[model samples]
Target chain A: MTVLEMRDVVKDYRLRNGLRSTRLRAVDEVSFTLEPGRTVALVGQSGSGKSTIAKLLMQLERPSSGEILVDGEPMPYRGARAAAYRKAVQMVFQDPFGSLNPYHTIGHHLARPVRLHHPAFSRRQVAERVLDLLRRVRLDPDFADRKPHELSGGQRQRVAIARALAPEPAILVADEPVSMLDVSIRLGVLNLLATLQREENLGVLYITHDLATARHFSDEIMVLYQGSVVEHGPADEVILNPQHEYTQLLADAAPAPERRLARHRQPTLAAREGGGQQPLG
Target chain B: METTTQGTTQGSAQSSPQGSTEAAAPSATAERRPVTRKRRLFPPMTLKLGVGLSIAGLIVLFGLIGPLVVGDPSTVRDIGLTGPGHGFLLGTTQTGQDIFAQLAYATRGSLIIGVVVGAITLLLSSFFGLVGAFVGGWVDEAFSLLTNIMLVIPGLPLVIVISSYVPNKSIWLVAAVLAITSWAGSARVLRGFTLSVRSRDYVLAARIGGEKRWRILLVEILPNLIPLLASQVVFAVIFAILGEAGLSFLGLGASGSFTWGTMLYFAQNGLSLRLGAWWWFAPPGLLIALFGAALSLINFSIDEIINPKLRSQTRAERNRWGMSREQRQAAAEVTV
Candidate 1:
């Protein structure tokens, strides 16, 4: 079991606009802990430092300040410890099309991580593991031989998920994994991730803009606005009783069928009066 | 529990679209499989490629086999400065040396230099280009600076100065000089390509997968560069061959070797052109032009692989345009 912790992480970017350089704080004093078998949905709009936080967790970018700890131990920068950290914390990138190497087969993608983490596994064992991974992600075993272009977007995402799971990581950082995929297939992919998280007891950081899925899929919801967490609580409480104005705006933006039905059935007296007086105003 | 049921229903709903895609995939793969298999057996051979390969192949075959079948190129004959006839297929040079034998030997020698220079250029360019870009920072700065310096220096003048400085010049030395001068251009191209490729998400994904740096560079990045590399190598070979010819024609060619350039130099010295002994000078010049054209054609075909937009119109497309006015009118009437 692994507990991934981000202690007051702040990420800044040096932006240069020809001769005058300015600092842009992408993430500001954000802190969170991801315990095994739990999901934390990071809900935010575009340019809200959602990806920066994910990059920090994945060690793709270094934090400007503060520390990241794995099981109460500081994250290693390089060497065997770093490799171990990577194996423990894997990520599923947002763009499946871009994430997969077009030159390689799906089997090659999955088999690589398995072979990296488990060097003792034989070639046959690796092949078996790749097929097993394909099956786990609801892909046909035949997909192992196919290049990424041959597969649909959803299938490719499944392959990406399978590749992430190949090392049997304790923490999976899904950085808007389904945002690039079709809406019809989004729930299926999320459900698969949820199922896999449950099966392996993986700590998941599900970064997304869709508040409905955020509330439904995660145990806790963190509403981020302009690189800062505006509200954080139990998923339903954060959605139902938003404490911050940004969170309230976000909650109101999400289309709710029941709310729409209620509004259609009965327009409030004030709303009716306002509708009647709209042209004069 | 309700969400799980909803998810299952959606999952099943998801399969309908997936099933349509799955239905489409098999036929797509079916069309793709034979094409891939055919490609494995033989790369897509355009008319230009076919002609280029055949010409190059014939020249290479002549170089390989013609030397063994012919007599000594330098042997002095009684029939001095004769035209094509009298038991001499390409006649005699001004000094009575068999022109055919000299041409054969020159082709072989020139080809040797081309191949050697191509290999060296491939090594140097890929090393400076790929390694620097992939490893970046000061190393990249140093390499880019070196490449820039090399690029700015005029190639032929530098080569002439280097060749003039080195006495007892051999074919290998000349090849090395040509390779050193030509590699910088391709290195710059490779560096630009490598920079673009190294930052691609697949490469980043490989790094996040705990893959070693070298493995990611070799496995993730290198394979994508094969078409570009192949085209660069071909261009290098053509440059090397042409550069050597130019050097040899200036009488600064390898002292002992009988390259096409050296043959031209000897013919020029003997006043073969003034005497109207076209066999001596013309064969080598024609061969050089033909070989260069052939290699250029091959390079163009390779370029099409790198950028598909360069490919010419297909037969059907051309045929559509080729229809006469009557045929066009008939086709229009049929459509109506």
Candidate 2:
């Protein structure tokens, strides 16, 4: 019942020059579905239409020609219906710093969703709910009164996750949620998302370009290259034995620890063999 | 890589209270800030704020209670052009109207018109500017066109002509004239602000979060525009009061009321300046200047608070860690 499906969605942008128009396809005949309790990773590099897919699912932008279905029903078109649908499907944006309003306190951010979803809840109930959400995100309740500027990256991302979770959304579309974070903390945020997905039975569409995290975190991986899905299957099949050439290129690009060490050693070895200052590459 | 690293550190700093955020920020900022922290009377209050509060407090005090303590401004209770006598502390006008009472009552009219016009202009400008920028395309084109059309046209001449055409004008009518003419400038500025602010990721996030347009405008957009709005109101007040005085001096003021504009009008008509009777017009003129200064100071103070680029260099920063402050001072001395 909680399946979110994209059916052959096509999105095009019309570039205009003195009334002459040309179309550029951003997402070309793309199709996928996110099922409850499963994590679907949309993997691609920048401008490969990974985020455009996320935007399309969030209904921030419309598909030029395609169908998006929520449990076999067409996505809501009008404002009221869209708002109601939003309560069931929420988003955690890429940049946590930019996504959360700076002027508001953490309490304010957490309270808004609860208040919107449960209008019948008393003020005390809403307060407790905010604390509960903060707790769920592994944040201190005292952090609620602080502004967005007072929180760390991981903490802010956690708050953002908590906000997305506040409405008890069955589907969560997180677009590059950890790419901007420090390398050290990225795993912790990914693990939190994975844990939340399992606990809530949420359909998580985790959008990212980093295939390493995608392999470790996602149940299924969909490799997107230049707006088309080049590869899609179980995470292991996609990463360990990539079927498409583009997916192979991406896999090759992701440097493993041993590969990085070998690469670093080669440069020094090359330097020893009169390759010093030989353009470093 | 640097941007992402710095962003992570800043983000952690915000979340962590006084950790890596400060550790990173201080190194970048410490050299620039030589002035060390000291005990401040009002820690948050800026210099302009204190000065503005004092002046504004006086203006309000006069507007509220000054008239109540004086006799009626209209009553011709003394001989024409008489000095302070018979309890008339500010002497009498050419027509024997009490100058003190006139100044007090005039404060009310001038303030009333200025405040109302400020409110009206701010409303119109904010609505046009924010709505246009937020919902761009044809709506923005239309708004920009209207604003540009109004801006290029001479505002005062337009106000004068429009005011002249209206028969039996009141203070509110004068305010309306000022508002209609003056809102163009603020709308243009606000449109620029709104354009930049509307693109901030939080605003987009709020929109995608299912918050309605009005709520996004009010909650997300409006708080960011407070300083701009405050500055606009300050400008609007200055123009409204000045406009009032100009129109009234031109004999377009409400006939029944004694506004500052009318007071100046009467003073000019009676040749008070030529006759060496300074009491007639100087007080209202001085009050206008005082009000202008007060609002300007408040605007200046707020600018530093809201706009980081304009913040004062001599900030009170505590030299907590080492003799870096002393070392910087020595380095500055060496440079000098």
Candidate 3:
């Protein structure tokens, strides 16, 4: 069953220059469906509108024109409906370092979302639940006492995950969850996320610029470019046999192990550096 | 790995890291020796507590304790006019009150006016500023217009005019008037800060997290503003103190109250300074300088704490004083 659906969504942001000089179509005519207990990755380049789609899905930015249905119900933009919608749909941001408040301890950060959503939980119960969440995310429960700055990058990301899960959200919108992590710990975080998704049966809309991780982490993939989806299919199919020219370009650009090894085996580093590199017009 | 995890869990069960939820969290640093010292220390609570404590301590000592220990500050004495004696520790005024007593009691009034005016100004400025910046469009334009009007008008002159018109205005009343007029600059600053914060992802998160606008402003954005707002408040208080003293020195403040400015005004009027009665004028002048210095020192300390670059430099300086190369490297690595 489709847990979340967006139909023909479009977002246009007005530039600071008073004339509405530059109209940035962040998300244009983008449509996708997220099924229950499935992970869908949105892959793209820096300005490929992948993050914009996540923002649209999370209602961080309202689409200029579109329909968003959550669990076969039309999501309202304000008041009671909006509150309910927000509770059901939570986000884990890309930059773990930038995501959590540096001022608050991990316990404080986790407790807030939980308490806000489920006000009925007694203080003691909430405390227990927070520990469970910390443990689930692979963070030592004791780390909750430490502030965001006290934790390593990977630990902080785990806290972010725990915070997102505090509400027991059915759909988790993880925007580049492991992008800013250390290369060594990046796989661990991804594995932890996949573990949580499977255990909780969460519908995850994972946004990233890395296709390699996307292939491992997601069940399906959507390649976004210039405010639109260029290609969409099963994750392996899209990664292995990219259909669109843009998808192929994205695949080629991704720094896969094979590419790195091949580059190392080249006759001369400088000569091989420029080879097979396509210019964007 | 299992044993390490179990050990971490066991250690966590002992005390639990600071405020962690479960008992399974490590107590301090036993979890496979995870890099636990990575946190920054410039949180809002520390900032608030530090500033609040300094303000409280200063007020209690100078304003409350000093006055209680010394005799009535308003009365003047001529005996110990520059000659130190057993009774007059800081000497005596031309009219013969204890200079020490007067200086101490005067702190109460000066600090009161400063705090009241500064707090009022901060509230007004932050409120209008956030409203203007966050709620943009017509509201911003209207507030900008108001700010511009306040900006262009000569503040000191306006205060002189306003104060002169009123009959025997008390310090608090005068402070209220000053607070009313002085909020424009702060409002402009806070508005700019809020405008920037409004674009941040956390602010966006708060909005989507079902937090009301007021909560977002107060809880999220306002907390971040402490480091900046704190210094702003100190500066405002200093200005307020100066303004109150200036008015009193000019004989425009509360006629009944005996503040440093009042003493100065009286001493000048009585021709005490010219007559070599340095006790009266010097006490108040020195008091003003002392208060200014204390506030400046505290502000400097706060600035060091807030700005990581400064904090790191300070750490480096301390390291230079004592730390070994290996110790410094370990500290650096631990932080990462």
Candidate 4:
């Protein structure tokens, strides 16, 4: 089984100030292990360094001073080593519409990865592989010919997932993949990710803002706040019994039915007694 | 904590987060996009394009075989028979040359200069524009500076100075002068286009896919600009043709050249207007205007075809077919 680990990864970016520059640590000693068939949720709100972490793992941005290792070896930066590493790690970006190349057909999108990773595969084999990948994502075989713009949001996201999976990467870094999608189709995508994770035994770094869905989906939850992992544990433990103040705040902010029910029940009870209002839950 | 301000900006936002493909990449509307060709010069062409192309086609026909039809105008015919219904057809000038023959030969040179200059301009602009945008930073700054300097220079005076070295018979020299002066404006426009296209998500995705930079620049970036580039080529050709005519008419372009410009030059020099040789000056000038009109028509039609939003009809259609969120959901349900 493959294991992807980031050992004390700290990515610091330098902001320009005319001639002088100051360092800003984006991912401060953030560390996590993604084992095969397991999902690790990087839970954080906007500007919480969740995306910076995603970028670091995707190798789109480099960590300042840490080791991102595949198996036991540190990830290489250039040449065949980098290309091989890229083949093993593929990202499903946020904004499915933006992720896909609008000018190309869905087939061209899938073919690119397959061709890149499996150079020996014939044109016929690549075509077959693309069709198979589309089917796995529950997309119609006919969709392979359509452009990104022709497809709906859910359909485009599925295509993006299919494109990511084409290279047969060991680890899937899905960066808030469902956030930009419609609420109706979001569950379908989440379920698809879950199914794929189980079937392919792919290590998934599922990044998101909603702890509620992250609880249902991720095997492990790491609550990121202000560039540090404030809380990290097994999914149910984090959700059911949170220790950190920020985590508790997130839980409180989450729209739970019980809280709404209690608030509703309080108003009626007070009206029946014809008394002053009680405190809200 | 100071952590709030620490990583507030990674400067990655300046780079693309997702590396999106377009600024306002609206959905490719389903209904009428097929009106644009999947292949260049392909069928399923719009009525406007067809009409414009027909007009252009006739002018192109004139350029190609017009001289062959009437033979050489310089092969001096009967003199002093200056009328519409004479055996000389469009009648003879004071120099006894056939006006019809002059017009035919002039079309060949004028159209040739236009096409050659346009092609040269396209090559120069695309070279400076695409590479500069893709390779950015200092290279981009240099190209920007070059374009700005070229744009600021007085084009007509520059053309005049350059073409002065040009011999009377060398139409190519005149074409080259026009090409040098005209490319900067188009290059700037193309640079903006390249800058926009280079930052697109697909380009970034290609980079992540480990696609070679050259391949991304050539296959991916260049093809997207072809429609707009095609329109630019037509505009450049029109500019070059008119520039040549204006220069030659001013007696600064290729002397004795069988272009419409030289024909007008000769007509003016020979005092054809004062000498009652209406057929002498009138045909060449009329042809120039007609050719200009034809090219402009083609340019507008190409614009209409490639960018459908430019058309009022498409806008009206979009309004008619456009849906709100609930309506889109309803439509989705119906389709399902």
List model 2 lDDT by residue over B54-120, tens digit each. Answer: 9988887888898899888888754888877665788899988889999989998899998999999
Question: Each predicted model: what fraction of the native A–B Cα contacts (within 8 Å) does it retain?
Answer: 0.75, 0.44, 0.39, 0.42
Question: What is the C-alpha DockQ of each candidate?
Answer: 0.70, 0.47, 0.41, 0.34
DockQ, structure candidate 3: 0.41
Best candidate, TM-score: 1
Q: Considering TM-score, where higher is better, how would the candidates rank from best to worst?
A: 1, 2, 4, 3
For B192-299, candidate 3 gives per-residue lDDT tens digits of: 888888877666766656777877777777777787787778778878888888888887876677666777887788788788877667777877776776676566
List clashing residue pairs in candidate 1: none
**How does candidate 3 fare on TM-score?**
0.82
lDDT of 2 by residue, A1-281 (tens): 36889999999999998889998889999999999888899998899899889888887899999899978989986867778777878889899898888778889888888988898999999999999999998899988877787689999999999999998998999999999899999989999999888888999999998988888888999998888998999999899888798988888788767766665767867667783543211
Per-residue accuracy of model 4 over B1-336 as CA lDDT, tens digit each: 654543454343445443253323444444435543263444235666677788778878977887888956877655664765586778777777787777778888999899999999999899888899899989999988998898999999988877776555488888888899989888988999999989776776777777888989987788778777888899999999899999989888776668889888988988988878788888889888888887787787778757766765766667877788899999999999
Native interface contact recovery, model 4: 0.42
Question: What TM-score results for chain B in every one of the models?
Answer: 0.87, 0.80, 0.75, 0.79
Error of 4 at B296 (Å): 1.8
Docking class of 3: acceptable
lDDT of 2 at A197: 86
lDDT of 3 by residue, A1-281 (tens): 33799998888987778755888888888888887699999988888788878888777777888888877787788878777778878888888877777666789888888888888999998899889999898778887787777789999888888888887778899988888889999999988988998998889998998888889888899999898898999999998888899998888787667666665566375475666653221
Q: Provide all candidates' interface root-mean-square deviations.
A: 0.7, 1.4, 1.4, 1.6
lDDT of 2 at A182: 91
